[model samples]
Target chain A: MEKKVLLGNEAIARGAYEAGCHVATAYPGTPSTEILETIARDYREIRSQWSPNEKVALEVAAGASVSGGRALAAMKHVGLNVAADPLFTFSYTGVNGGFVIVNADDPSAWSSQNEQDNRHLARAAKVPMIEPSNPQEAKDFTKLAFDLSEEFDRPVIVRITTRIAHSQGIVELGERQEVPVKPFVRNPQKFVMLPAHARPRHVFIEEQHKKLKEYSNRSPLNRIEWGNKKRGIITDSVAYQYVKETCPDDSVLKIGMVWPMPDDVIREFAAGVEKLYVVEELDPFIEDYVKALGIPCTGKEIIPICFELTPDIVDRALNGKIKGGAYPKYETNPVPPRPPALCAGCPHGFVFTVLKKLDLHVNGDIGCYTLAALPPYSAMHTQGCMGAGIGMHLGMEKAHGPEMARKSVAVIGDSTFVHSGITPLIDLVYNKGTGTVIIMDNRGTAMTGHQDHPGTGKTLSGEETHTLDLELLVKAIGVKRVVVTDPKNVEELERIVREEVAAPEPSVIISKRKCILIK
Target chain B: MKNVIFAGVGGQGVILASKILMEVAKNAGYDVKESEVHGMAQRGGSVDCNVRYGDRVYSPLIPREEADFIVSLEMLEVMRKLEYLAPGGRLIVNTEKVNPAPVQTGAMQYPPDLREWISKNVKNALFVDTSGMLKEVGTRKALNIVMLGILSRDLEFTREQWESAIKSLVKEKFLDMNIKAFNLGREYN
Candidate 1:
């Protein structure tokens, strides 16, 4: 075994590859983008792509799994929210081949906009969740996730945090194991999941969960170390490693598969240990779960239900010997707030600056332009999830006539526009809402570390592929007034926004700018 | 023999310099666990890296307040990572100033004469003309490595190890240039 330093995202991709992942799909979001990208780039046997959205990603992976190929669908924490509808039903329909959903959670919004705890979704969907602590575990758990998925005939969620996804560590590489493609056995009663078949499948899913939990009780993934009985800690993922490092004297039950918790194993563990404490990030998922079994525990109360936990933070929370204020303190500087800004030379910067100069009520969508909501460019008055700007702008135009709408424009990132901006653009065109939708085509997705989307003429793994032209996409949607302009030219960009805002019909303006990081 | 943490904002070259130090230590045959913050945090954010060196390195994680040398590339980053340094340990700081996320957010106040400010707050501090040093060398990107060159005076790695590391880190095409830059930095101090 050779030890090579690898990022956690790359490690997970390697693990998926070693486990014979035939198909992988994901939507680009930070902390998780590299997982699919690395798989697509490094693993020649594996087929991977950046799906249009998280929902489509899940459906595509699910379709691949039904064809009897091991598949993986990855997304950030919130992307799960978009994919949850299919995820909930997939648990009932089950999988013909192993299907693992990698949810890279940004616990502190380190690379994300939200710090959502995703274990709730795993529990809500009755799917098992595996949390890995470091790069090595990130790889191992991914392989194990696929195995568990096939064994239980259900999709497993391998939940990882931002720290674990970005952190680098030495991982022992493993050999890839291939699976023969199975024939499509058409069993409509099992595969279709119609209401009639779903009821039985739901019961089967419950039984499968119990069997999996029973298996977990004896599984090597979860372990108990004998030590001082008092101050017993129940932790998983990185928290387990922190507890081990900080409170080594205390006995601990380290859990990897947090959901469908091994009831018998935990019950025995709690009975043997005293003063049970739970250490977890974001939520009291494990603490609450163990307590539900009538075992008393302290969690979130002392461990904090927010942000990541370091060894120092864990030591202090556990009332250990770590000195007070020993950890890195948050910055305390009273300067003007510059929540990330568009670079000085950014092409999009000029366009937003001009839009603000024109005093246009710009509804902005996600991307680098979202930074326009801040400083010198404060052009965006409203910004939300992908494609919301167009919808919000259409609503504004419908409420207030064309003259009023003339002062408003919807600005969206080109990649985001393709992802969800089409529906709103169609609404504006068919329903006669008069407002300009600026598609900020920054070539690559600048915000989430410059991953390629539909418009970049590249695939998820930086391959040369057919790039979707935004102008053609807009024209196909029947938008009459579509224009492209270099965003660096502020005068031209502002003139276009003002002119399009006054146009009577739905219009689209593709503000062409190569992302600063990419270029 | 000791751990050092270099905390700074993105583009401050803290990561590159820390990597240079780690590489130097490794070339000197000392075990090293170097941890970095990759992906999102590197884009104009408060970024820091850890370098733990000894005969044996147990884990990649460095304990809080255990760092023997704190090399701060930006002022507020020093304030942010002050606890990492031992109370009586030396702080090598660049007099250069850059606002951190909190400062830019108007949530905190930027300290004045940041090097002196940290000296006032910390137990032992040394202020260095990193900006001037890099300018004298005719390259702004080498500021952190130059600061690290200044640090090599008190550290374990020999000048030869530092030179070897610079050779290893930079691309082959520019290796000779970076080695000259590193040698200039080593000679200045």
Candidate 2:
């Protein structure tokens, strides 16, 4: 076996290659973005593609899986929310080929909008979730997740946090196990999701869950480590490393299959120790499970539920060295905050400057344009999730009427427009809403490091592809007015926006420019 | 375990410098774990990475007041990371400074006399004045490697091992220039 230092994201890609994953799809988001990127860059055998959004990414992987080929899809935590619709339904339908979805959660909101614990999503959807603690497990668990997915006839969720996604560690490499595709047979009840099929499928899911829990009791993934029996800590993912480092003397149950928790092992370990503790980041998923099992455990009671945890925080909390879970104090001056900003010469900078000058209420969506909500060009007033701004603007126009529409504009990046913005633009037009939707067509996805989307005319693999025409897209969707102009041309663009918003009709403004960082 | 941090503005090659050190440490048979925050965090924001190498590295992050060394490419950036530095940790500062948005837009001022502050507060601080060195190094982008070269002085690795890492990681087209930049940094008087 060959060993090399790899980023956790890289290890996930390496695992996919080793598992002989044939198809991979993803929409770029922080922490998760590098998974698909590495797959595209390193694994020549894997056909990786960037879907418009997480939903589309999952559905694309679903299509590949049903066709009897191993498939994988990955996205950040919030992206899972977008893809949850299919994820919930797909869990019941099961899989013809091994399928895995990598959900990389951001703890402490580092490079994310929120630090959501996705194990809740995994449990809510009743999908088996495999969590790895570091780069080595990130590779090993991901490779094993595929086999588990096929054996159980279900889609597996490989849940990770920023610690496991961005952290780097040594990983031992293995050979590719190319499993032949299982032959697909046409079965209406299994493939199609109707009331008749879904009703029984729901029962099938419950039955599968029982077997999974039984497997969890026996699966080597959920192993117990022998240590001092004084303090028993049940932990998973990157928190296992923190627990091992800080509370080395404590007996531990490190659960790899976090969704179908090893109930028997958790109780056995709790019985073997004096006191039980649960060390997890974001939410008290394992803690709640241990308590439900009638095993008394201390978790968020003393541990700060907010932000990410470290060895110091865990050590202090376990020993009662800190009161009220106060963060460790450091004697240092309050340095000037270096908040995220639009890059100098960023195309969005010009548009935000113009909007600020006009004193208009800008409803902002995700991407680099979200930086407009910050200092200097505090133009964006209402910032929400992807595509929410477009609809929010439409809602304001419908509620407050023409004058409000004239005073406000909805801004979204071209890539985001492709993600979830198109439907809202159609809503504005179909419902006869009056507002200006500014598509900041910066030629690529800028915030997540310039991954190409539909509008960029380039695939994730840097192929020359068809560029989606933004102007035609809006106009074809019943928009009467669509203006394509240079965002940097402040005076001319300002005049166009003024005219479009004053007109009592839906309009689209395509602010055309390439991101400054792009070559 | 030795905890090293590369602190600077987003585009200062902090990740690259950390990666090079990680590679060298790995080659020298030490377990290393490095952590980085990119994505929107790299949009002209403060970006830093932790590089921990030892017989067995546990946490990729360096707890507060535990960093063994902090090498920064900017003045204020290094100051921001002072909390992570141990009381007796070495501080290597690049005299160059990239003004944060608030400082650039006049909302706040970049902390003044950082050199004086470092001299008084830190037990050991080495300020690398990049102005004269950039002329000899021939590029500003190589300042990261230069910072690594200065870092090489305090580390246990041989100069040849460091050069081998640079050769493996850096593209051959720019190998000669990067080697020169690294040497100029290593031999800086």
Candidate 3:
């Protein structure tokens, strides 16, 4: 095996490839997007795809698994909220071959709207969770996740944080193990989630949890290292590295499997050390679990419950030093802030510039266009998560009536519309609500490094597929008035926007242009 | 162990410079780890990466005031990450200035006395004329490689190793120009 430097996400992709995963699906969200991308770029054997959104991604992967093919779905922490519907049911339905869900958590809200810990979701959904510390572990554990998923007959969640996801480390490469796909067996009682079928499956899920807990206790992933008996630290993922670096003298209990936490193993380890501390990022999930087992542990109270943790933080916290005592504050004036901006020649910039001139309240969706909320072209007024723009635009129209609603428009990107905007656009047509939608068709998912979506004429594997026509799709959804106009034509765009918003019926102005950054 | 911080605005190739450095360090048989900022922040925002290499690296992050090297691609970004530089640490900075949104919008001004302030406050600060050097190469895109060239002077790696790292990473069309840029950086005062 040759050692190569790999990002943690790339390592996960490598792990999936080595595990003989036949299919992989994902929606481009930071810290997790690269997993599928790397697979698509590097591994030709596996079929990789960028689904419309996280929910659809999960369902696609789940469908592959039900067909007895090894599958993986990757997404960020918040994306789990979108995919939670399939995730909970998939937990009960179990798997035919194997299924692994990669959750890249952002503990400090770095490049994210929220700092959510998806470990709770793993526990809630009654699925086992694996946390990898570095790039090497990321690869090894992803392979292990598939094996555990098949053994337990359920999906596994492999969680990682921003630091681990983006960080680069050496990983030993291995050959792909071609696991033969199992024949798809039609068992309604197992696959179907009706009232009667789900009732028994719930009991089976509980039984699976018990088996997982026992497996967690003995799994090679969970191990204890001896150092100073007086002090012990319990940690996992990237935090384990910090604890190891900071408290090299202290005994460490590194938990690779975070959920269904090895109670017996934790109890045994806690009994050997005089003082135990849980060092984890974000929530004190392990600390709470340890305390519930009637064990005394120091966490969150000593370390912060907010933001990402570092070696200096861990050293200062345990050494009884006050926060900020670990290092000297350098004497320097604060630099001017450099907030992200729209590209110089971006088509969205032109659209926003026109909207700014119009002085209309533009409801925005997530993507590169979200930057329109900032700077000289502050055209967008409100932005909720993906696909919320159309719904919010409709709500604002209904609340203020058609008179004020004429002054508002829903702005969404091409990829974002494909993600979750289409359904809401239909709601506008069906309910007879008059809300103008400005679909910023930039020809790709421009925000997260230009991954292909349904609207883009390419698949994740870079194959030329059917390019969705946003104008036709809007028209097909019963939107009476649809106009496709280039945003570069400022005069024409301004005129069309004003005309559409003034019209009584539902209207869509497709701001058609390619992303300036996309080659 | 060596901890280096590379700071610059998005599209300046700070991340690529770090990657090249990490590869060089790894080729030298040292364990290396790097932390980078990606996604939304790459849209002309302040971006940075931490590259640490040694016998063993446990944490990718470099604690405040502990970095041995601060290689900044832009002047303001250097000021923002100045706290990461340890006492007696080398600050290899590009003289280029990228005006942030506030400065561009006329809400704020680029600090006029940045060079003087840095010299007075820091003992070992080297400001390389990146734009002037890249002018000879006829491209500003090679500025990062030029900066990396200057940084290579202070590192333990050889010229061959640095060149090889660049060869493996840089696209073939731009290879000769980047090599020239690297040489220009290495020869910089």
Model 2, span A164-281: residue lDDT tens: 9999988989999887877888877877999999999999989999999999999988989989988888888888888887777878898899989988988788889998888888
lDDT of 1 by residue, A1-519 (tens): 765556688999999999999999999887788898789779978899988899999999999998798999999998898899999999898888899999988876766667989999999999988888788888999999888888899999999887778765557899999976667788887789889999999999999988988888888778888799977888887777678767879888889888878888788888988789889988888888888899999998888778877777887889756664643344453333324556657777777777877888989887777767765566789876777888898888778767767888888887888788899899888888878888878787777777788788888767788888889878988898999889877777777877887778888888887877775
Fnat score for model 3: 0.65
Which stretches of candidate 3 lie above 4 Å from their native place? A320-334
Candidate 2 Cα outliers beyond 4 Å, as residue runs:
A321-334
RMSD of each: 3.6, 2.1, 1.8
Tell me the spans in candidate 1 whose CA falls farther than 4 Å from its real position.
Answer: A320-339, A398-404, B16-42, B51-63, B98-112, B120-123, B130-139, B147-170, B177-188
User: Model 3, range A1-519, lDDT digits (tens) per residue?
Assistant: 888889999999999999999999999998788999899889978998999899999999999999899999999998999999999999999999899999999978767878988889998999999999999999999999999999999899999999999999888999999998889999999999999999999999999999999999999899999899999899999999988777889999999999889999998899999999999998989999999999989999988989889877887898753333223333454567889988888899889988899899989989888888887788888987989999999888788888766788999999989999999998988888898999999888888999899888889988999988887898899987899999999999999988998998899998889988888
Ranked by TM-score from best down, the candidates are: 2, 3, 1
| Cα error, candidate 1, residue A280 (Å) | 1.0
Report the Cα lDDT for residue A78, model 2. 97
Per DockQ, what order, best first? 3, 2, 1
DockQ of all candidate complexes: 0.31, 0.57, 0.60
Name the docking class for model 3.
medium
Colliding residue pairs in candidate 2: none
Decide which is better by lDDT, 1 or 2.
2
Candidate 2 CAPRI level: medium
Candidate 1: residue pairs that collide: A333-B108, A333-B109, A334-B108, A334-B109, A336-B104, A337-B104, A337-B105, A338-B104
